[model samples]
Target: MVTIKDIAARLEVSASTVGRALADDPRISAAMKQKVQEVANDMGYVVNRAARMMRGVSSNLVGLVVPDIRNSFYSTIAHALSKCLESADLQLTLSETDDDRLVELRHIRELTSVNVAGIIIVPTARPHPESVRLLKMTSCIQLLRRHASLGEHWFGIDDTQALFQATRHLVELGHQRIAYIGGTTDLPTGAARLQGFHGAVAGSKAAAHVREELGAPASTDFGRDAIRRLLALRSPPTAVVLGSVQNTQGALEELHASGVSVPETLSVVGFGDELGFRWWGPGLTTISLPVSELATACGLWFIHQLKQKSANPAPYSSVSPPTLVVRGSTRAVEAANASRAPARSRQLAG
Candidate 1:
């Protein structure tokens, strides 16, 4: 509970002199500033953030809204964000929306109400018009996701390039029959990744046997269901590219239950470097999203936007390319198995 007054009394200086020193005001002499700082440190004094905000000096608070706290990708980013923001002497307020638009909107309103210096959001579901409107009036940055109409201040890996690279990896491995699992076309990440998959497959020999299993964002149940559907196909894929870590776990469970050996009968590549892979007997080959990098970039962007509130914001933004991590779950396709044609690939094209 040490205050500026306490430090001033001990130094026999005016409280305003101590305040100016604390603010790093150039008017305060360097010798006096150092003396005030030493006294403040000795007295265990800390600037009250709430009081500073009230005085319009600094809010010292940032809000972060994530879709799911349990998701490894989001959690990793949150950890990095907290660490980075803390180093800058700022506090973070975190909220989870569980992919519910209403909940996300409410969280945004609450954060804005508290007058946080800025907000970093990973939106639940697609971008809504109302959310865009709210963002226009607030200092906010979108992280690992984007809203179609929201101008700039977004940071996320190039999902499309990641998927395309994954598909091409399978192609290079002699996997002509490849299936994609998780995420529906309506979601931006899903659509972008799908486009990347298609782009890589186009005009390729394996393009004839590519199949997609689109649904809700990856979950254990969804993973099982998508696998079941893929297995039911007359010519099941020899290799699969999974969209999320959750789906990767579910797929592994289903594969194990069916006694299907990974990278033996089927090769699996997943997105996100889930923690489960560390312990799983067969480590999953995954294209790990740069969560920490994205988070740090978003944090820096949020700070920049807060400082440039009056400047015109950029229109639509994204992060740099993602890095792909290859692990043990996937292997070269057997020539005999790879030679078989996929019926669905032909049907879809027809």
Candidate 2:
């Protein structure tokens, strides 16, 4: 709680002198600035950033809003962003929105209230109109997921392309029956991913049998349920292409619990090359996204704009291509019996 008055009292100097010294103003001599700084540090005096902002000083703190941090995807991006921002002497303040529009709106209001240098958010599928209005008025970058209302200040991977690549990989492996488990079409990302899966199937020369299971606000539980339903079907998929991290986790868990052997019995393709995915049962064949690189690129661009003091930075967006990492989780259908019967449990239904 130490303030300018406390430092002033200790140095026996005026409060204005203390303030100017702390700010490293040219009016203050080097000796006086050092003296005031040393005293301020010794007395535990912290800079009141809000007060400085009221006087029109820009904050060095930036805001990062995400839907969920439990998933390593968000955490990885946070780490990359913090490192780049720190290199620029900017600090990151993170807020979790739980993918809720109301929570997103509140967080936006608070960040703008303090006049943060800028905001980088992995916005919800549908952002609040008010939140969009406020973001349009500030230096904001949308990450991963973008709402059309937020314009093109965005950086993300192609969701549709990722799924298309995954599905096509399965198709190329000679798997005729494939199931896709992911989010509902209510989310733009979900819609795009579904479109990609369908596109791959439609374009395939082979007779691809498609089984899609989409749930609103997809989670591990939904993933498990979807996989269970697909497996209980009369014609279970020979291979499964997971559409999200949660779906991958859930499907993998169900496969393990049901004692279904990966590739040997049921082939699996997962989204998000999470570190642990490499060790899950058989190593997971997955879509590898350059999440860290994307984060670093966005962070650097935002820092550049901040330094340039561009009140209205041009609308810029970039898409990173996802790579399909072939691992032990998938196999060619040629090795299996001609029946193409999936070996997973047929008793449980989604």
TM-score of each: 0.84, 0.89
Which digits, one per residue and each the tens of the lDDT, describe model 1 over residues 1-350? 99999999999999999999998899999999999999899889988877876666547778889888888787888888988788667798889988888888888887766667777888766655777678777677778677756556688889899999888888888888999986876668888989989998888888998898887765878988999999888988889998877888788788767766666677888887767764454677888777888788777666666557655667547677876788776787875356334312221100
lDDT of each: 0.78, 0.87
Best by TM-score: 2
Q: Pick the candidate with the highest lDDT.
A: 2
lDDT of 2 by residue, 22-104 (tens): 87799999999999988988988889998988987868889999988887888999999999999988999999999899999
Candidate 2 Cα misplacement greater than 4 A, ranges = 5-18, 24-36, 205-208, 338-350
Mind sharing the TM-score for model 1? 0.84
After superposition on all CA atoms, how large is the RMSD of candidate 1?
Answer: 5.7
Scanning candidate 1 in windows of ten residues, the lowest lDDT window is 341-350
Could you tell me which 10 consecutive residues in candidate 2 have the lowest summed lDDT? 341-350
